[model samples]
Target: MHQVAPDRSWPLFDVAATRRIEQAAQAALPPFTLMQRAGLATARLALAIAPHARRIWIACGPGNNGGDGLEAATHLAAWGKEAVVTLAGDPAALPADAKRAWERLRQAGLDLAPAPPHDCDLCIDALLGIGAARPLQGGLAAAAQAMAGVGRPVLAIDVPSGLHADTGAGLAVRATHTLALLTLKPGLFTAGGRDAAGQVWFDDLEVPAGPEAPCALLAGPPLAQPRLHASHKGSYGDVAVIGGAPGMAGAALLAASAALHAGAGRVYLAPLDPAAARLAPGLPELMLRDWSSLPLPSLAVACGCGGGTAVADVLPQVLPQAASLVLDADALNAVAAQADLQALLRARSQRSLPTVLTPHPLEAARLLGTSTPAVQADRLAAAQALAARYACVVVLKGSGTVIAAPGQPPAINPTGSARLATGGTGDVLAGWIAALLAHGLPAFEAGQAAVFRHGQLADRWPAGEPLVAGALAARAGG
Candidate 1:
């Protein structure tokens, strides 16, 4: 058994693949061996998590999940712990394994009750596993609700009761700790899974999954690149940020500052409002230029930080001229609102020019012609659709920010926290990605690397100090 963390990459399987693995494991092992292993693992983890607790409530359902709980109850009773079991399903209607487990519990003199025992320190939820598809109802629903409301730590046997293993949808059990059996599901790391399954643990039950392709990947930490002594400033390449129409000049300047701090060789800032501050006084290195003066064909261009309506006028030129482009903020909105711009954006794929689109939920909704809730319902699917529609890498920015590209399995970023929820951080991310693009990384890799670093800044921010956007940009290099 091991704990799940963001330091290493993990293969995420869907419900179908996990079922296949389970079946194969059961066929190879002796009868009830898997359940016994699961039971033992659960008991050990429970004891480890709360060793001093005298009473542990084990909630059992009608399936194999409940069987594991029954087996655990027997072991706990034999070990001198007061294990109280509240069974939600009919004993006669249980599956073969669960029925056998019930017999074992009865033989050990452990009686099953209909309601949870009071004054319990820990609750083990074995009500519903990954097979749950419908709304939680009946006795199982009541038990799950009690467990969630009890305010104590909950140890879920497998995937949370109601969360969809494939899409991370549905009203799921909010477990304090979840033990993923056999394989890790993608839902545990993305969408609503992160909040639902707190402090996730993984125990394969000694069952090795056979050769099956993973459905998604959990993105890990990025490698550090060492600058060579022989390298010059020009070796890093140029990046130009074009946005800041009228009142939103701060947005464009934030991107420029981030690009500079992220190691861009030469950074240029072009504002849609020609009267916008010509120079970023604090950072004298940033060059202020007119949009027409930019050699878009040679530099990596980050557009739409705050382009407003003025960005629409320049998109036609930027779309065709920039060597590599990152369309963000208002630029993404402009593309979503105009079919001509969308056509031009899609045409870049045929020319083999790299492009990345960064959009929050609302911008993504506008682009896809759907509501924000619809886009967030299944973030992976939404991001994948955007990538396919534009034939480019799509970074759907939010919790568990998803990175998707054409013909590639999506990656769920594990870094970042609520500290990034403040304004201007999105602008910082756009500049960070633009810097990586200028460094010549592929669009997908650039998105992942930049996002990883950008979030790492927030994750490692000093506590008690406010995490504003300017400080975040400066710390992108730190």
Candidate 2:
């Protein structure tokens, strides 16, 4: 078993794919072999996590998940540890594999306890695995509550009970460490999965991935490119940032500064507010210009950082003329409000022009004409829909940012932390992506790399020091 980390990319499977893999593995192996492997893996991991614990509480359910718990309890008992096992469902209703496991536990001179111990060093949650589709009730509910109230480490088998293995939706048990068996589920890395499944570990049970294609991918660290000695400033290309109406000049300046720091050959700032130029003395490297003065056709333009209502005036020109474009913030809102701009945006795809849209959940909801809750309910679907609708790459920013393109499987970024919750971070990301685009990266790869690096900065931010947007923008290229 290996721990899941962000150092390398990993394939993510949905519930249907995981079930298919399980079925194929079971058909090829002897009866109950998979369960035995799962149980042994669970027991070994439990020992490794809490070796000194005398009492280990194992909560077993009515399905095969419970059988895995029963098998684990037998091993723990044989190892001279106090294995407290409790069955939350009727023993007579247990499945074939679980019945066999129950018999094995009985043969080991162990019996089910009426209740969990008042205290234990570790708690194993096996009440519901991938099959959990509804809220917990009865003995399962009580078991979940007990595990929560205990305040001890919880090692959940397969998946935390109640979390949707496909969409990462639903309330679930919060596990300190979750051991993903057979395959890694996408839900564990995105949406509520990141919070529900802490310190995720994976054991494939010695089975290889089947013929099924992955539903999504967990984005890894971007590959580093070395700059050549022959390269010059012009080799990187130019980036133009347009936005900053009135009081929100800081937003546009933040984007311009980010592009400058992120290795753009030349960064130009065009503010909607004429007075905004006076406020940007700190970034001397940024070339201040009128929006109409820049050659839009030759530049990678990042529009709508803080354009407010003024951004609507520029989209008509930016949409069709810019060589490549990244529409963010108010630009997205403008397009969501105007059908003509939406049509213009769609025409760019037909012209084979590269475009990327970076929208937070609310912006995405506005573009989709849906509620934020609906968009967040299935982030992957929402992102994919937006990409298909606009015929461009869509970066759905949230707890687990989803990057989707027209014909490719979406990617879930795993690099960021809550420190990014502060203001102007999205503006910083927009500029970072613009820099990558100016450097000649494709829209999808640019979004992936920028989102990964942007989050990695927050992930590596020094503890005790505040992580503000200005600092984040200044560190973008690093």
Candidate 3:
């Protein structure tokens, strides 16, 4: 069994992929080998979590997931812990592996409950797994609700029952900890997975999850390369912030300021309005440049900040030749509306230019021509779709900012807060991403770091103080 953390890279699997791995591992290993390992792991985790508990409630189902629970009950019994089990369906209805486990539990005299285990120390939820076809109902629903009401921790096997293994967006058991057997699921890292499967612990059951198509990913910690003591400003590279149309100059300035603070050697602003030169009083370091005079690919370009409608005109040239690109707000909207621009964005994917798109749900809906509710409902799926369509790294921003690469597993970011809900925050995020790109971080890392840090600032904002966009950007160092 391995551990998963916010700062580490890990594999994420979908239902089909996970099933294939289990099948392949079963075929290669002895019959019941994986089940034994799963049961052992589950038993160990239960004991560790609720060591002094007098009773364990095992909710049995009709599949292999249930068999895993049965096997664990046997272990718990052997260890002298009182085990009570309630069957949702007849034992004869169990699948082959589950049937064997049911027989083992029966032989051990461990199946003792028709009623719920009152005041049990731990509720082992084994009612369903990736194979669940629909929502939990009947005895299963009552049992899940009962488990939740107990106020004790529930340990789920394989997955929280009823959750969509691929999307993590379905009715699920409120498990305090899930011993994900054989493979780590992508759902557990995104959507409702984070809350449904608390503090996920994987066993892998000694099963090898071979190479397959991954639907999403968990990013590892950022690297540990040290900066040279004698490094100069030129070492970090320059960044040019483009997009502040007339009244939205603050957006461009926010991004410029972020890049400057995030270690960019220098920062420039190219505004849609000619008067940006005289407007920014507090920003003495930001040099204003005309769109025509903006530097090319040598500098990372952050486009569409406060762009309003003028972003459409600037994208044609910038798409073909920016050093690196981070598109936000109106720039993303412009690409969504124009087929010509969409083709250019797609071409960037082929060019392998480091491109990132940071779009909240509404902006994402504009890009995909879908409803905002659809995007928000399955954020991981939406982010991955945008990445595949544009062939660029995509940041589907919202409660859980999903970072998806062209052909890599998406990382569901675990940082940020409600404080970032105000305006200008996205602009600050765009700038931070631009700074990372300017400093030569890959498109994937650049987006991940910026989104993570942006939300982190919001999460750690001073309790009594207001957390506006400008102040949020200033806390980038934290």
CA RMSD of all predictions: 1.6, 1.1, 3.0
The local distance difference test score of model 3 is 0.84
Q: What is the Cα-based lDDT of residue 106 in candidate 3?
A: 80
Candidate number with greatest lDDT: 2
List the candidate 2 regions with Cα displacement exceeding 4 Å: none
Model 2 lDDT, full chain set: 0.92
lDDT of 2 by residue, 1-478 (tens): 9999999999998989999999999999999999999999999999999989899999998899899999999999999999999999998899999999999999999999999899999999999888887888999999999999999999999988878887777788999999999999988887888888888999999999879899999999887867789999899989999999999898898898899889999999999999987665488889999999999988999999999999999999999999899999999999999999999999999998889999999999999999998987899999999999999999999888999998999999998989999989999999989999999999999999999999999999999999999999999989
Question: Please, what is the TM-score per model?
Answer: 0.96, 0.98, 0.88
Local distance difference test, per candidate?
0.88, 0.92, 0.84
TM-score rank, highest first?
A: 2, 1, 3
lDDT, residue 106, candidate 1: 95
Candidate 3 lDDT by residue in tens digits, 345-427: 88986777889999998999899889987886688879989999999999988766789876666887766666778989899
Estimate, for each residue in 12-87, the C-alpha lDDT of model 1 and write its tens digit. Answer: 8888999999899989989999889988888888888888878999999889889988988888888889999988
Clashing pairs in 2: none
